[model samples]
Target: PPATARPAPAPAARLAGIWQQLAAQNTEIADLTAIKNHFERVLAGRTWGDPVLLHGDLTLRNVLVQADGGVAVLDTDLALTGPAAYDLGFLDASLDFIDRWQVLSRGRLYDDAGLGLARMALRDGYDAGGAADDVALCRALRLLQRAAELGEHVQRTRPALARVLIPRLIHPYFLAAAARALGVG
Candidate 1:
């Protein structure tokens, strides 16, 4: 074979892509105002086969490397009854974003960049142990969440991170998901 790849679309990739499709459709300014409510509603209604407690916003910064090589998590702000693996995906995405977005000139973390890194790290930790198969779906949903948040911050000016955070954390995350879901990548 010229190149070897599976003929079937990975379950995880398809899962990740759904959020990207949702994000692209919700590009309008209204999605932000309605997003948090949507997530809450969807989460409350849906249940997966492996449903378990989840940290809604698990990321690298939340996870602590223990002296004995164990991982610990903090920040239950995003916790819900959902996929634990998805939580790990968020962490992994955070790590990747941080590594890519760091600016030596400022010698400090930027808004989206730092947040991305935190997300990537969480996912990486999870995927590394085989969750990689389904990590894409979680990443996609993350971006959709970001787009919604951005819209809200745009009009209200509360989060104040609409441009910086959403672009860094949400856009690429969803795009990555889209690629996986559509098999463009």
Candidate 2:
């Protein structure tokens, strides 16, 4: 294991702000069974490899970009204990969300796909102790979590942006929620 990935926060608290904001607008399922199901699955999973002192809350935000096109990490909260794959996944997911956001907001001017190429390069950079599969899992987690945030954010306060964003999200959320239910990613 390496000190890169981090464990995801419990969904309830992570999504709490959103839930509060959407308490009025979101009339979907207050039953919360789906959300509960997700938590249950996440809590039941295990590492395919030995756990290491991971960089808890691992993501690109913790990785500083240097002027020379390199990175310097900050905030070693030291709570980073988990499988190395978790770090890979966390970085992938954060980068992916940022890329998708640019495209969603700025459209043609922002090349979201560049994130994919960057991810591959980063993956290659970490080949020494890399587990791309685990990284992919982390990335997917970030995507869906951030996506849920986007939904709650736009629908609550930024209705205009929500007009553009919500339509783009419907299908992705459906699949992500399904995958979460299965505990596969």
Candidate 3:
């Protein structure tokens, strides 16, 4: 089996702080500027009601199925107090974009029916009618956050990759998908 790309999880609170800092200090990157402003607009006058401890990243790669028919969750670095829908949105988006990543594509779980079933199962497992609104918001937020993190990662470790990653894909995708979802565009 190929190794999973489970990047270190930074808490939602920390991410918010970083977003603020970036907005204040880093005005040179056009993508970051657009994303920050979009999120600011999308989140304006909105409040996350009662944040709870979330697994943060709940993709299939982070789950372990044991011989005893039990499951073990790994990669807790991104765990934090946030809307529970954050986890759900990440899982759902993982399904929607599974084909986008090499390792995830290997799982071959990108079917729409499968994704719908998985989301249904998730709602049932949580015994909630589904946090529809928060899920939508979190889905957009998570996408933007992931793109931002990837941009930072490439900038720090693989500076050359930034030229191809930032404006070309990450930034645009994040801005479009998130802004569209949030009706901010």
Candidate 4:
């Protein structure tokens, strides 16, 4: 059977979905609510350009080590139109999980210091200085997305466990990350 792709929703709609998820699950605790408000504030503060193609899931796992000693990207099914820093910020967000980059690029790209340096280099190379706020917004969006997904799983699968995990663990982490993204941490 042939498959048809649905158009990706605008960024505001995507964020609204996250908010709806939080409301539906009654997971809008003070910390999470604050984070959400700050996230929205950050988004509102930024000036966005016309949406462009973005790798929605730009993680290390989606990067391929080509045979010719170059690099390639994979699993682009999630690609869609969004802010340019959506993908770039995703790389930054996923730095903690990117154990390696490749043969020649592998040493410490995942380390905190290394990631910071890499971010500066990328910003310089791309001359994307103005995209810093966009990157922060994207990072907050990523955290919210994760928290929303986890909230759904907990609500549907383990309500009791969620009571302990959501507030103490998941929500706190998301809030802290979002706060850092907003430069308020």
Best by TM-score: 4
- Candidate 4 displacement at residue 51 in angstroms: 2.7
lDDT value, residue 125 of candidate 3: 44
Residues 1-185, model 2: lDDT tens digits: 34354554443454454345434434354223354355456545633554555565555446544434454457877565544655666665555454546446645443434444544545655554544345544554445455566677777788877756664554246335435533644
Q: How close is candidate 4 to the true structure, as a TM-score?
A: 0.71
Write model 3 residue lDDT over 1-185, tens digit each, in one string: 11232323333554486576334323255555565666666566666544455566788666554434344568977666555677777776665553247334555634444445555666554335224356766666667666667677777888877777766776677667766655664
Cα-based lDDT for every prediction: 0.48, 0.51, 0.59, 0.64
Error of 3 at 65 (Å): 10
Residue clash pairs of candidate 4: none
lDDT-superior candidate, 1 or 2: 2
Error in Å for residue 44 of model 3: 4.1
TM-scores, each model vs. reference: 0.48, 0.46, 0.64, 0.71
Q: In model 2, which runs have C-alpha deviations exceeding 4 angstroms?
A: 1-46, 56-61, 64-71, 77-79, 100-132, 159-185
- Inter-residue clash pairs, candidate 3: 9-78
Error of 4 at 137 (Å): 0.9
Clashes of each: 33, 7, 1, 0
Query: Against the true structure, whose lDDT is highest?
Result: 4
Instruction: Report the backbone clash tally of model 3.
Output: 1
* Candidate 4 total steric clashes: 0
Candidate 1 per-residue lDDT, tens place, 121-140, comes to: 55555555444454544554
- TM-score, candidate number 2: 0.46
